[model samples]
Target chain A: MLADIEEFYRLDRLPHIWCPGCGNGIVLACLVKAIKELKYDQDKTVVVSGIGCSSRASAYLDFNTLHTTHGRALAFATGIKLAKPELNIFVITGDGDSSAIGGNHLIHAARRNIDLNVVIFNNNIYGMTGGQYSPLTPKVQKATTAPYGTIERPFDLAKLVEAAGATYVARSTAYHTRLTTELIINGAKNKGFSVTEVISQCPVSYGRRNRFNTPAAMLEWQREMAVPVIKARSMAPEELEGKIITGELYRGHAPEYVSEYTKLTQRLKEEAEGV
Target chain B: MPKDPANIGKPEVAIKDSWCKGCGICVALCPKKVLVMNAQGKAVVACPEKCVGCKMCAEHCPDYAITVEVE
Candidate 1:
């Protein structure tokens, strides 16, 4: 089986460091499947990630992977993309890594509409740093920091990115493996900034505290909570509450950052030559 | 016993216990219910005959613990 998809991963780095029942692997597999289906040039594709369990995926993929500082995967990826516009850049980040520390970068990147595929592994807590509640953690969810249940509302990451001007925005959970892969593939193929928020499971860190003691239970929760975007359209707001809307939520075209920059450079060169 | 042509050289689900964390994603996702967790919690192919080589288990296994191969 490994032989079938050997080119997509660095098998030598197998036995990944993620804890048992962690959904990061499922997201990773989906991403690999999407890349394979798209037939992207392996040599020209770069996987960038920030500090977190999900970020560790950069090391496992056999692409031009970059493990950047905490909350700075997009920042690093921005530079990489500007320098080499031909490369396909995919940024892998976690909830805490992206929504909290890297919140500003995420917004700016989306606003710029850069040609970057961003996948957020939203496990609701900081799994790598000990189950702390993240910006995406639900209002009543228990976390190390929120022992008595969180008081603040969680960030709707897909909506946030869409509002921030991302060309593509979608959401999916680990249980919806096929949907996740399809959304990711579409996100990757989008011309401008694309964000796919994968509501992953942190069984050990998140589940034990939230009564979802096993990966299967957490996934089942995801299955129950996820409603397709089209189906969700017919449901009332009240009925849609607490349910994740999965599928392509939005897709719109805009001038990608790299191409805009190139045009600017050409214009400036023409002006200089005229002078 | 005469073997059906469709059943001849059928694929078998292989379990790599050392890598399997017994998450049961494969068990839940198996369309044919060909797998079940044993006493040790690791997934085992309970009915290989039911396996249609959909490879859903292989594709979704987080641990890369299950693989389907034709003998």
Candidate 2:
């Protein structure tokens, strides 16, 4: 098993930290494969993360990474890209980190249409600080904090990003490893801000409390909820209601953050010269 | 001959002793012989050089204690 892992993974760093059956490790594998396939300059690529189990992604990759403050990976990444526009920036964040405390930053980053790739690991709970309810946790899902079941409705990450003006928005799950990796790789290649919300499983916290007894059972739930975007659109609102739509939801041409900022710099230079 | 000499480096693993309940599952599951129990019986990296970051400890930890941080 380890031999197979070493062939594609960083073998020296064996025995990862993710709990048994946790989906974060799978997501990490997908990300690493995507990076390798793209063959991007490791020196020019930066992986930024906030506090959470998923945030550990920054430390694992052999690239320029920034482990920033909670809910602030986007802010730090924005500054980094604005300072050095040539770098390829990737943000790895968990559901709680991106949508709850960092919700404002997430929407604003998309609205600005920055040239950053964001991978949202939506496990529906706060796995690091104990299993607590997250913004993406479905209504009535039980969490450590919501022992009686969560009453509040959940946030639709893809719709939120699309409405915020993200140039590309897609959804995938750890269950769909190949497709998830493809979405991440394509998101990286997209010029304007691209976001992929990966609805993953947190067996220890999210699953155990929500009545998912085993990892396999939890994965089955994801499979059931996911509906292809094309099929979903053809169905009426009644038919599509309650179904989780997966695939590329929205893609449009938009000016990247760097190009827009470049125009600003050129204008400033011309004004200074005239003065 | 050394197999890709430049590829050799330190082993990596995500250690969260606080999350470890000393269940010893990781010790039993890791095929690389990488994890070991410390004085308190919590899982620790004993032969990390043998580790391949296969994520066995993380995927198996019932407590969500560890997350592999590779470099």
Candidate 3:
């Protein structure tokens, strides 16, 4: 409805290349709005992503952006954060890009507790690569590779990152757009590593392969499956079966890697001068 | 120019036609039934007066095509 245009978006890329019902656009909007609400200096903020459907978000965002190689977005982002800790870095990675080929980078980054805001677009399948089953693909969810359905259990990325040492972690769906934005805002505010895993829909890749006839149906499924963190606590484990627990899953204090590295260098500099 | 007559004093729910992909997300998610997909499939405000300015349609629009101003 913006008559002029969203200042945060690249005018040349007015209409994004995402599929008609793909939730990538919604997640991208959430990320940008979160950045706006935080009043971050656009010039100081950097958006990075690896190759995939969701990674294309960097092309539309009007900021210091990077389109890195496959599954290595976190590695590139970590290097950037180390080089220029003052700039706000946001990684826009897909489930496959973050959890499959780049899985090791994901764990190490969370383990380091670096000050980077990561937003994983968990669309389940490897959409850009033509519907291959990714690591986060829910168990028994059909993909092109898994003609019937995936047999392996999917990783609960929020729990994975929390255990790996992320200071803040949250999971939200594209249907819950406002909640996704709010989680990103809080995650960005966290001092250490923050992960906001958005359960975005891949209507073309994941839906058609499965039984979700329309994107609306998938959205409704998300609505039915999502249970807030506060509400989930009271329900018994059995009652939570098949329900996705969303909201702030974890928030803890930790020594940020960047600051610790800076401290080490400063101490060495003082010691050298004293000698 | 074909604004619904009932929209006289309603909060504006403006939608950019060019950007809309007709995903129907805004229409389905609009709790007030204030939006509908026109014949061409772009979303239009059917009853702007019912808009509580929650921005459900605006915020959830995948194409970033909807906007609402309560004031």
Q: What is the TM-score of chain A alone in each candidate?
A: 0.98, 0.94, 0.98
Candidate 2 per-residue lDDT over residues A1-275, each given as its tens digit = 22223344434444557776677766777776677778778788889999899997676666788999999999999999999998989899999899988999999999899999999988999998998898888888899889999999999988898898899998988767677888988998899899998888888988888788767567667778889898988889888766778888889788787899999999999999999
Can you tell me the DockQ of model 1? 0.52
Which candidate ranks first by TM-score, i.e. highest?
A: 1
lDDT of 3 by residue, A155-267 (tens): 88888898899999999998898899899999999988999999989999999989998778788899899999999999999999878899999999989999999999999
Enumerate the chain B TM-scores of all models: 0.83, 0.76, 0.81
Ten-residue stretch with the least lDDT total in model 2 chain B = B2-11
Of 2 and 3, the candidate ahead on lDDT is 3
| Maximum-DockQ candidate | 3
**Candidate 2 true-interface contact recovery:** 0.04
DockQ of each: 0.52, 0.07, 0.58
Output DockQ, candidate 3: 0.58
Output the lDDT of residue A12, model 1.
Answer: 84
| Reference-based TM-score, model 2 | 0.77
Alpha-carbon shift of residue A106 in model 2 (angstroms): 0.8
Clashes of each: 0, 19, 1
lDDT of 2: 0.80
Candidate 1 per-residue C-alpha lDDT over A33-67 given as tens digits, one digit per residue, 9 for 90 to 100: 88898899999999999999999999999999999
Native-contact recovery for every candidate?
Answer: 0.47, 0.04, 0.61
Better of 1 and 3 by TM-score: 1
Error in Å for residue A120 of model 2: 0.3
lDDT of model 2 at position A5: 30
